[model samples]
Target: MDLPIETTRLRLTELTLTDLADYENLIMIPEISVGAGFNLVSNPKMLGAVARRQVTAPNSFGIRVKGRLVGAILLHEQVGFDYQPDHANLELSYFLHPDWWHQGIMSEALIKLIEELTASKTIKTLNAEVFSSNQASKGVLKKAGFQKKTTLIDPLVSKEKVIYQRALR
Candidate 1:
């Protein structure tokens, strides 16, 4: 919920209504959608709707590189979905522009985010689901200290979804 979650070469901040254009461009890329699950952008109206919803969602952050919106991250509380009494299970999701892929920027950003969130003690667990074919995302989560828990066959995508979890304590 804070603005400008600063990393060495990037800034993570909340998405705003004006960021729709950048968000649209980022998610519409074929490669980006493949990993980020951007089916919500199949049509213009749906794209607009998803973009608008992103800006209003709680704990969604736009990742910026040198003042340009190049990616986005989200932390969602999974209420009643595998609930643990003492720990809040928050889902972590992120996407970076294809052009910025393999540059280590995303890994750095994620490490910084985990540090901040853990220090705050607001979230007790961080969870992520990555398509089995998404090697980069799998690597990012591992580098951020998340352990692979299990794999589920996602019917919609017809691919294995690797579930990763990191306890924030």
Candidate 2:
């Protein structure tokens, strides 16, 4: 799959197997994973598995800075979700390098991605599960026009998460 998404100073592409090392390092960062659904680096094979899965998944994109893969922005199609009964929504997720913090690169990539995906008519609305402590991501979603749809307790993580929604139109 040839995934390429461009922003003023960043690119959002697809994840690859080579990302395991970086993903491992990133997972170890406390700030990056706080309230994140996954814990610290304990599964490299799982990361590889996800990369393989994303190669065929239409909605997942790897965010890049200066042509280097830095993070990922993901989406789960509405059809297979347990929340299918809720008026057509796809779940969104993102992660970035701690080095990229406060650079506005994510905000740029996010807005561009939302615009491109919506313009392509791939999805009508976007939703996100934001961990309460991950304020950086929460702000990105809000700036990208996502509004709080609801809050739910993630059974797996046992944490309060916010469900944010945004209409493409």
Candidate 3:
């Protein structure tokens, strides 16, 4: 996949350390943090450490609008899922600032990302697990062609989650 994939209203770029402050502000929002299963971190150092890991992760992109970071999208190896790590399977996760919600920003970003990854021909399936209550996220996934694969209680979070998957191959 390429860096800085752009859509009409947004830019998907490699997330960098420079985006730390904006990232912090984004995750500090209760709806975002709690919905994404992130514990609110009051310690700056801890937050920085977490941010560092996210920014450096492969396939992580900062969702920017007018040059301001407002959210992030990331694809990584499936962890607790049954899928094998064959490089063709990945888990998708993302969060957007509440202020940007309901405006189709996340759906646009996700659709573009799906197109790019599918064109790359290196990914076969993209999986996303959202808390059952996150209707907005489910809507975004559905808009991007993901279908609900299953519903189960996530052991890590102890919450009912809906698993969505998009096949590229």
Highest TM-score, which number? 1
TM-score of 3: 0.90
- The order by descending lDDT is 3, 1, 2
TM-score for every candidate vs. truth? 0.91, 0.79, 0.90
lDDT of 3 by residue, 1-169 (tens): 7778998899999887788778878877888878876665668688778878888888889999999899999888764455455578899999988889999999999999889988999988999999998888899999999999999998877889999999998
lDDT of 2 at 101: 80
Q: What does candidate 1's lDDT look like per residue over 34-136, in tens digits?
A: 7777773568787778878987787888889999999988887776645543336788889999889999989988998888888888788999999988888
Off by over 4 Å in 1: 81-87
**Weakest ten-residue segment in model 1 by summed lDDT:** 79-88
Indicate which candidate wins on lDDT: 3
Local error of candidate 1 at 128, Å? 0.5
Arranged by TM-score, best first: 1, 3, 2
Worst 10 residues of 3 by lDDT: 78-87
Candidate 1, position 138, lDDT: 95
| Runs in model 2 lying further than 4 Å from the true structure | 1-3, 18-25, 28-30, 33-35, 40-48, 80-88
Clashing pairs in 1: none
Candidates' C-alpha lDDT: 0.85, 0.72, 0.88
